[model samples]
Target: MKDGWSVFYITKNAWEEMLRDINNAQSSIYFEQYLFNDLEKGEIGKIFLEALINKAKEGVKVKLLIDSVGSTDFFFSSETVNLEEHGIDLRFHALSRKNILSNIFPNLYRDHRKVLVIDEKIGYIGGVVIGQKMEHWRDTQVRIENDFVPLLKNSFDAIWNSLEKTSARPHQYMNRHLNENAEGFLGNCPREKDKALRKEILSKISRSRKRVWITTPYFVPSRKMVRVIKKAARRNVDVR
Candidate 1:
């Protein structure tokens, strides 16, 4: 572990590690994933669902958030009803009538973050989802054991609390811990049109001296971002 963080390169391995952590959680488990699939087909999803149910039975606070569009299948499945029956505080982000309109023109307004915080002590952040299809993808996950876990938990809480209350804002709830981490800060695509994550990524790429290597499934970046990347490449920054 590097300064209270352990990075896992394989997607399957990350799932296994998270499963272990979920089993060992004492107080709470907060999970937010973009794509959460059905348990029947996805072994990883089944394992995690079982673990969460068991923990909730033991009186642990289990909260889960899934993107409405990405996890549409799972959200409508019996497994989600089972989670609610087991007293799991499961919620879907933006699973609404407006979502039907969004299908025509998807934008950055969706919640696509993958994060998990257990007992407000251990946290996981990565690209892999709870599905069998993700097993073949080359993804990376970081398990963090530090005060930073609370920051992640707070972010999850902010989103959860904002689902019903219209006056409260997630950005204001998360602002205190946004830039507090000494090593690296937890970021999000703010609901109120704040492109904090995008700006940070662009700033890092613009300042890269030797190389900037990135691997992502989505490459539909903004035109300004495309220009910044081209400028970086012109400056002999090995961009890939």
Candidate 2:
């Protein structure tokens, strides 16, 4: 809803936009997703996978991070070998026994965000994942081409380095570079303890001047979110 930016509601154009960005990546491509499998989905799922491998083979630095539970089969499949052979730095989130034990009491908190950043120039964030089933589902994705790309890149680097057990310092986020074209700040929830993202959502709802619309495959919300919604409704704001 901001000027100087074009947002694509990519239910119909999801694969096209994703493949385009991956194919055009010059220096680097980073992807993080909850689902990265194509088992039952088949051929369509292989499209992006092949594209990533191709780019990596061409010397584009490519890193992919997938949630272990969501893409377990694909992560263990023979195709993963092709990724390694092609120089793709593929990794899984929460895939190790050490991580499980470190959680104390294991929970299902997942890296559910689907993000793809290409060469620090273009980025995509959305609900769409790499799978055939998603091809027919209604979903939205945004391709950002602005100063926000660095912010997205920093986030991907942080998560990627953490999964790889590297000692990379998280880049401090700076908003001074934001201009009129910049939409707004991006809120990240890299861990369950990170509540900034949830607070941002609740704050937006609380400040809604008109209606509030939400669409999620799952409706699980925190108690604070519930209270904010109720309060918004009490003020006669349309809550849907």
Candidate 3:
């Protein structure tokens, strides 16, 4: 955290590995997810719940946040009471509001993050979540140590701190420094004037001189992203 990012890890079998990290945590633990499925979801969910409860009982200062809309199983469910009984600091984000405006656009605003940080030393970020529905889904889960971790910690803190705000702000985001190092976190913030991340990616793509590789199970690129990719291809930039 005090230094810059020095290590990076991309893991496919993330849940098992991350569970080990959580089990070994001696200090603090931060667990936030978009889909923290019910403990009955499967063994994965049950073990993680047990691990967090154990850590909290040991006074490890465990904090858990989940999206009320995304993690419908955990929000206002009896399982929430179980976690709270163990002294876990559990909170929900993007709680559904009872109004005409909220009902129409409920899908537009929801926390879609899956992150796990153990003792502030290791962090796991990706699309993976706990649930039987996601058991067979492919995702990119990264485990990293030191350097860039502080950035993630800060981002988590920001969202955690502003849990009550009804704005569509994001969690961890990437800047130039982070992008230049290796991978970058992308997020959209309504509070920002220029929709910063999109602009930054456009600028980066336009200035590419070597190669560009884009991969997604879902292909729904915006018009501007399509333009940049096409422009890069015209320049023989090895765009994919």
Candidate 4:
């Protein structure tokens, strides 16, 4: 594992760690998510929102990209205005009622990634979202550090540049020092065919010495993969 590399088992703990990182951010914070908003008045949601606002007030470049469908209500609500007022660069993805047909098809192709890249040296990737319900879900996340930060930073830049914005600020965090040697390729669904993470897991299973334990909330394995597991079990390999 890299210097900043860590795993969070549950969503609530993940969010707490995320907020701590956000509070400590010195230069910039870039976030992309599937959903975000306040469900109750002056709730934890508001606290996190205000934290971003305060960071922006302190000259930390705060930019956010949210999926339109997942955050549809928030995108059109008054809350968005407040976020914008605090100098938060907020952009909604592919949302347009004028192009209803195109929007309908792309609804399935969401920005499912939950990413928080702070100071361009620390990056967080996970299944957690900015919502109360997500706290109850069993999710996993990774904190990364190293050369991969620049690649992640470049990806963020590409997405930011592709969006239409009135103003764009430089991410000073990109100049921050980093520890740990990290290198990995970006993986996106629909756009990319091979799921690198999936392949990695399968490879680990194939190389297992003793019992192979597997756990997933959703277990929709392919027929071919099922056959492999059955063959492994028949060969006196203990698999659970």
Candidate 5:
């Protein structure tokens, strides 16, 4: 973990670590999540809000991007106004309520990535989301301290800047700290129209030496992926 990353199976621990990093923020804080309406409505939410507001007041740049559908209530709340007033650059991704057409194409676009980058040397990517129910939910989040941190910020800026109406201040982060010898990192943005994640998964499965342990709550794989798994199983590879 000192060289690669630290993994958290419990979301509460991930959140506490995030808050600790936020408390020591020196330059910037960029955060994105799929569901966020209740982020500041619960008890832990209050602490996070206070910390973010305080950092903003201290001139630390803070930006947030949340999926609109999962956190629609947040858009109409006074907390939204309060956060904006406190100098937080808040934004909602892929508006599901744009019009009748948007409703018709519910699956066309959605931002389900949960990412956070603070300053220059720390980053987090995982499925953790803030809310009262999330405290008890078993999830995985990884805290990264490698060169990958800069790339994480770059990924955040991509969607953040696309929403021109949200006042996105896009800037390049110096990627001087990437983990060149580490495994590949991939991000799939709906706007990018790419199959990087699928391709990467297939490539890894094909190259796995001993075992492949995939523990997920939900999974709907493509026919090709199923075939690959079957082939691997036939070869005596532990395909669990």
Candidate 6:
């Protein structure tokens, strides 16, 4: 399944590619990441804030959603001021202390997705987070152009809609036309014991004919999944 996809290995100079894409975005840019950095202060963050601000100035609709806990400093400090000054709608996900009860119960459910959707057509998703640390950290990202963009957009809209009433937008693009043939949503929630997507991933790996190359910063797997991988390895399958 991954064969036809063009994989680009970005070691240190991958920022240029991301910047180039952001620079060329025409209509809108929707970014969601675990962290964001202000480039002016040399935080080793994804130094594309300037370009994002420039794009907004050029009449491009820009919306950035960053995790409040993961990007605590950038969210609370003045680092995000420039982005707001240029008409970019910036939001922090689930960083409020007022909701003490909810925070205590589901504090681990942070927005771990690193997604960038341009013009509601091209989508980027992967393990890459935006920051100076990302420059040195090994990571992987995929550029997708299939019918899955609407699903991604809907996921973002769900989060945006659940914000405080004052923080909610007018749902301008939420109901806009989407390309046909898009697949169903691939949702993930750690609290859910079923974990359908995770099961599907393990099932695919067990059925693969070629070598299995897993690359992830976090490697916490369930006991059933570990058994499946062990079984595959014992079957003389190439597992890595």
Q: Which one wins on lDDT?
A: 1
Badly placed stretches (over 4 Å) of model 4 are: 96-103, 161-182, 191-215, 228-240
Query: What lDDT does each candidate get?
Result: 0.80, 0.74, 0.73, 0.73, 0.78, 0.70
Cα RMSD to the true fold for all candidates? 2.9, 3.9, 4.3, 5.8, 3.9, 4.8
Off by over 4 Å in 2: 1-4, 8-12, 39-42, 98-107, 166-194
| Model 1 TM-score on a 0 to 1 scale | 0.85
TM-score, per-candidate, Cα-based = 0.85, 0.82, 0.82, 0.75, 0.87, 0.79
Cα lDDT tens digits, model 4, 125-225, are 76777777677688888877766766676666655564554435321112222335434545444433465556766776666667777766678998766
Q: In model 4, how large is the Cα lDDT of residue 213?
A: 73
lDDT of 1 at 37: 80
**In terms of TM-score, which candidate is strongest?**
5
Q: How much is the lDDT of residue 179 in candidate 6?
A: 43
Pairing residues by index, what is the TM-score of model 2?
0.82
Better of 3 and 4 by TM-score: 3
Cα error, residue 65 of model 4, in Å, equals 1.1
What order do you get sorting by lDDT, best first?
1, 5, 2, 3, 4, 6
**Candidate 4, poorest ten consecutive residues by summed lDDT:** 169-178
In the range 1-240, model 3's lDDT, one tens digit per residue, is: 234322222322677788888989999999889887757645667778998999899899988988887778678679888998999988887544677575655445666778787888888777678776666566677777866676677667766776745644443333332435655455555444557667877889999999988655677889989999999999999987
What candidate 6 gets wrong by more than 4 Å, as runs, is 1-5, 38-46, 99-102, 146-151, 164-185
Candidate 2 residue lDDT tens string, 44-161: 6587788888898889999888888888778778877878888988887665476666865443656677888889888888788877766677777888887787777777766666
Q: What is the lDDT of residue 216 in candidate 6?
A: 69
Positional deviation of 146 in candidate 6, in angstroms?
Answer: 4.4
TM-score of 5: 0.87
Q: Write the per-residue lDDT of candidate 1 for residues 90-137, one digit (tens) a residue.
A: 888764456666654443457778999998899998787887887866
* Candidate order by decreasing TM-score: 5, 1, 3, 2, 6, 4
